[model samples]
Target: MTTAHDYAHQNQERFQQQLIDLCRIPSVSTDPERKGETLQAAEWVAADMRKIGLNNVQIMPTPLHPVVYGEWLGAGPNAKTVLVYGHYDVQPAVTSDGWDQDPFEPTVKDGVLYCRGSSDDKGQMFAQLKAFEALLANGKPTVNVKFLIEGEEEIGSPNLGKFVAAHRELLMADVCVISDGSVIALDRPSIGYSTRGLMYLEMEVFGAKQDLHSGAFGGIVHNPAQALAEIIAQLHNPDGSVAVPGFYDHVVALSAAEREELAKSAWTDAEWKEATGVPAFWGEKEYLLHERIGARPTLEINGFVSGFYGAGSKTVLPGKALAKISCRLVANQNADQIFGLVRDHILRLAPPTVRVEVRQLASAGPALMDLNSPYMAAASRAYEKGWGQKPVYERGGGTLPILADFQRELNQIPIMLMGFGLQTDGAHGPNEHFVLEMFKRGIDTAICFFDEVGQIK
Candidate 1:
């Protein structure tokens, strides 16, 4: 077998240049004005897949952006087929958003590539394609490989589930490998075993038809902003625990062995503080940070908007207040069921002086891979060979809804989570970057992973 060290060293410069080219296109999926740019990015990815020797490359159309599909099944019918999944779309970025430079133009300095999609997915996905090219160019691949890169992940992948359901036969595989997560630490390699599900909601509280001067309506009318604040405060109690009744009734508790494993990978308080740049960390007093984020369910208010304050203070009671709320649910917690509980809680706690309305924005079920599967064992060996260290098992606080959908539509193929970005890469934040070293290592690791999966019985 070819070693990752030698393959990476041989093609570092070429891979770096290709990534820069891919990052140059502004493929933000949320903006309607960037529709053409989104298509351009999709085409670029499809062209690259063909260049990498992937056969039957095609740009499958969806209601939104296109889905890029390709496959190289030359390893014979007996060989295990591995499906690789990733996204080419990225979050919107602008200069006013604290960006150091133009977001679309990739910049490399001090071994870090800075851009909007560098770490979120484009860079990571590109690395896998490059790895395939390197392995094919060297001689021949031992495993059948398929690529299913999409262009609408940043927008909650609203159409991916439908696409997967419609083309089940085309996407059949022994197992699916996702290269979209981040490394635990820059120096240590980790594997994600599960992801929490998500329930996103928007709440609006209405007081009156229009804004009124505080002096004119002081103490006479209800303030929507105050009412919104009260509703939010009621979601939690003094112990920093969610007060939603029966919220924990359906949640599955982690096993004793799972708890021990989480404890082993648990970050120290100091490290947590440093990573978040906060003076201190706080959460449910009984659970540790890792447990609160990974194993436990959470309710978070992501965004809130109400009255206006520009330059000078305006004493006007806004007519309505809006809030964007999301919950990260653990295993056995259904998104729709949790959403109903949240809505009911808000209605019961809301003051009669104002009317509150809850709107469901999006939702996805949680995903967990069977760790005992042979595919996981192959991946463990692959990471060990690539990183020179045993890969640590971990779970992410985020959600990938389509993963669960894939399981329902296709056969129950064990999903593998593997990627080469770091947590500090600033995926959704300003000046997002992907480490050059990690990018190259990720390519090597992917190549090694293919070889290992091929050996699976």
Candidate 2:
């Protein structure tokens, strides 16, 4: 009897070519000019879903972009249903962004496929579809499957919350699996069980009513830029921790067992320096690098602009200064509470010389998955079978809004982040690529997960 793995191996060449084709489309969702190309990509996915025998395939419309949805529920209701989620949209790219070749033109070299959307999503999402195809070609899968491939994840998924809320029944399942991130290494797989939340804020400081000559107002009038810099300088203490009071009030402490699991995937200082090109690592001295990144909360000054930064030099004191700030919250901490604390601290730090204004731009709560769930166990077994290695568990430093949104709407389904790409895949950057072998293994892994989940009677 021909097995699904056999079918996957037989169609490897065709699968690679199809991924290349999908990567060719310039579906840069954040770019308004690429709206047509984005729609084209959605249609391509919907058409492929139909060809793969998925029923009720449709291009569901959102306010900005559309979502490509499909399902195969041939397995009876008694069987488990797996909801697969991924984004087809990619970050905007061009040769001017330091690309060696055209960003949209998919190229292959040394067993890696390079293109804008290759690793970010097009390749990962396509792997799920191919897995289903292989399973159906051999025989009926023990579990049902559904796909929710969106087009605006790169832009923070502005409309996805509403879309999911309106289609709760249609998208409900036993568990939701997402393959949109990166693993620790090509050979060493890692499952991300938690992600940090976000609180983005914009701050402005105003001093003089209008621009003034430095020679006249330099000593008498306080410079708004100077005030802004002083205020920002106090946001962090000399120890590099946030100075805001009650900042760590609700942070969850990591258990000794969880710390042991994280140690398995810890990057050496040399490796971190090589990747980040930093002179030295700086964070809370009490916590390890990985813990500071995934377990602890953080306040970062993204960027600040003021005065004259153009050409040579200008002798004018600008009327206002602006700074972009953000905080990464951990589990148990409220986004709103963090924002309020930061805002209040900044106000208190601002000198009476200049008027300060802080605005909340965006916010999202943190998400932690139930690692003990049987669905996660199935994923672990699937990785062992497909990747030839037992996977490690890690907490992601980044934030994915969809995870929290899914938890709230889907009755707390076990959301599995089964990322397939490697950390060095260069996602969202120039020369982004996906290893062809990872794509193949990802298909086999997905197949194994579906079959393994079916046994949960």
Candidate 3:
């Protein structure tokens, strides 16, 4: 009798083509103009779910984008149920963003599929779908499976919390598996147990009500742009730590044993320099680079804008300046409290010459999974059997808003992050791509994970 792995191997070509088709739709959730395309993507997922023998497939609408949900429950209720989560929406991309090809047009070159959403995370999500297809084609899977692919992950999943809250019984499961991130490398597989939270904010400094000529009001009026820059300069101290008081009050310090384990995955300075091309590293000098990224909190200026210079110099000191800031919070930190502290600090730093306003755009609390759960052990065995390596435990530097909700609403079910792609895949940037090998292995790993979970109970 042919096995699920054999079925997956036989359907590799078709799976690759299916992924290409899905990635072709530019489902950019953040762009209002691409609403139709985003809906198309959701419809596509629902259609495929029906094709793959999943039951109750639907395009559930939300305040923003819709969520595509499906499930297979051939196994009796006595068996374990695995909840799979991923996002179909992608970051906005264009050829001018430094891509050699159209971001929506999936391109295959040297075994890498280049396209937006391939790795983050349509490719990974589809792997779960295909794995179930293979399993059902071969025989009945011992464990039941459900899919919860959403369209708003790119925008912080603002409506997902409400959706999950309203559908607790529908989404309740034995465990949750998320395949939205990257492994340490192609050869070094890893499982993520903790993810950092995010707090995004926008700050605007106002002055002079209208544009003023630099020659007319040279030193008399304080330029909002200059004042904004001055305030930003004071946010960080000389030692590269945030100057915001109370920022560290709620942060949890890493234990000595945990620090030792994190060090195993720390990027060497040479590797960091090779990947980033930075002249040198900057941050708290005491912590290692990995600790600074995965364990410590961070404040970053995502973007800044002010008076414009079209072609030549406009010679104007614009009325206002705007800056986009984001903070990555660690465990035990609250996003709302941190936002208040940062906002108050910025306001205090503002000079009387300009009016400064700070507003929060988004926030997600940090989440830590139970590493000792049997589901995590199943993930480890799956990686070993499917990818021929024992996976290492790592703390992810990125944020996934749904994990916190799953923990809160779903009775704190164990969440396993079975990342398939590599970090160098350039997700959310120019030349984004997913390796064909990773896609195939991801399918195999998902199948193994289900089988391993089946052994439980």
Candidate 4:
């Protein structure tokens, strides 16, 4: 009989080609023009599952986009069940958006495969699939594995919560693994126990019914863009903390032990500064870098829109202005409450000349997990076995709403986050790529993770 290592080592070239093939599809969920293309990507995932010897593979439809699911239960009920989550969708990308190569076409240069979705998810997602391929190709897996790959994560997962809530029974598992994020480095594999929540919104400020010539209304009326900027400027303080009332009312203070664990991570402030190419670091001044980023709540303006953004100046007093806003909520914070405080603050700051409207585009609560769970330890062991280093525990500063949803839907099961991508993989950006060396190591990690979980059950 073949071993998982033999299958993985022998099939390295095939797995690389498969991932390159997956990256070739431009499954941009945010673009309406690419709806058919996104569905095509879903079909590709489903077909891959079938070819890998999964059963009951199907493209489950959601109101907005489709989810692809497949399962292998050959290990039977005495063993633990593992569920995996990842997105088949990617952020919108095009050559006009500053790409050195076609955004959809996959190319490898110096051992890096460049393409949108290569690292953010497609590459990481492939890690899970290839694990099953290696395991089952050798023998029946020690744990039953189920895959839930969605196509709407890039657009705030507008329909996934409802889908998971509706199919709780069919999706039940002992543990769930998500590979959408990245470790600090190839050697410093990390696992996260908590994920920040999200609240995204759009605020509109209307000054006049129609645009007026600057010469006619220069001094006579207020500028909507300037007013909007003023409101945004007031959101933070000199210390870089949010100035909005009650913004940090629910923030959970970091425990002393947690602070100690955070100090042990392989990342350093110097490495962070070098990677970002920033002059210096700035955030809530009182907390450490990790504590400030993942353990606290944050508010940011995603984008701003106003008049006269064309080739030159149109010389007009803008009739209206708009700003896209988002907030990262901590464990005890509520997304709705944060949105309310922000909306009310905007209303209070608006002058009588302009009408303010804040529309809540999306929201999801933050999630905290028990880092001491046995399976989490099992995952750490797997990382050590595959990557030849002990893994570190960390909290994710970004929001993966589905992680919160899975806990709410299947509270009895533990969730595992084992990321194989690197921080510099350039996910959600132009010329995105994944390190081929890390890809091979990630497959080995997944193989070890499944084996480790079997012992606990």
Candidate 2: global Cα-lDDT?
A: 0.91
Evaluate model 1: give its lDDT.
0.87
TM-score of each: 0.84, 0.92, 0.83, 0.82
lDDT score at residue 123, model 2, on the 0-100 scale = 91
10 residues in a row with least lDDT, candidate 4: 260-269
- Candidate 2: tens digits of C-alpha lDDT, residues 385-452: 97778999999998888888898899988889999998788998889999999998899988888888
- List per-prediction Cα lDDT, in the order shown: 0.87, 0.91, 0.92, 0.89
- Model 2 scores a TM of 0.92
lDDT of 2 at 20: 89
Model 1, TM vs. native: 0.84
Spell out the clash pairs found in candidate 4: none
Which prediction has more favorable lDDT, 1 or 3?
3
lDDT of 1 by residue, 253-284 (tens): 77777778777678898889888999867778
Candidate 4: tens digits of C-alpha lDDT, residues 118-210 = 998999899889988999898678889899999999998889889999999889998999898888777788888888999989999999799
For model 4, what is the error of residue 224's alpha carbon versus the real structure, in angstroms, after optimal superposition? 7.4
Give the top-scoring candidate (TM-score): 2
After superposition, the stretches of candidate 2 with alpha carbons farther than 4 Å from their true spots are 95-105, 213-220, 309-318
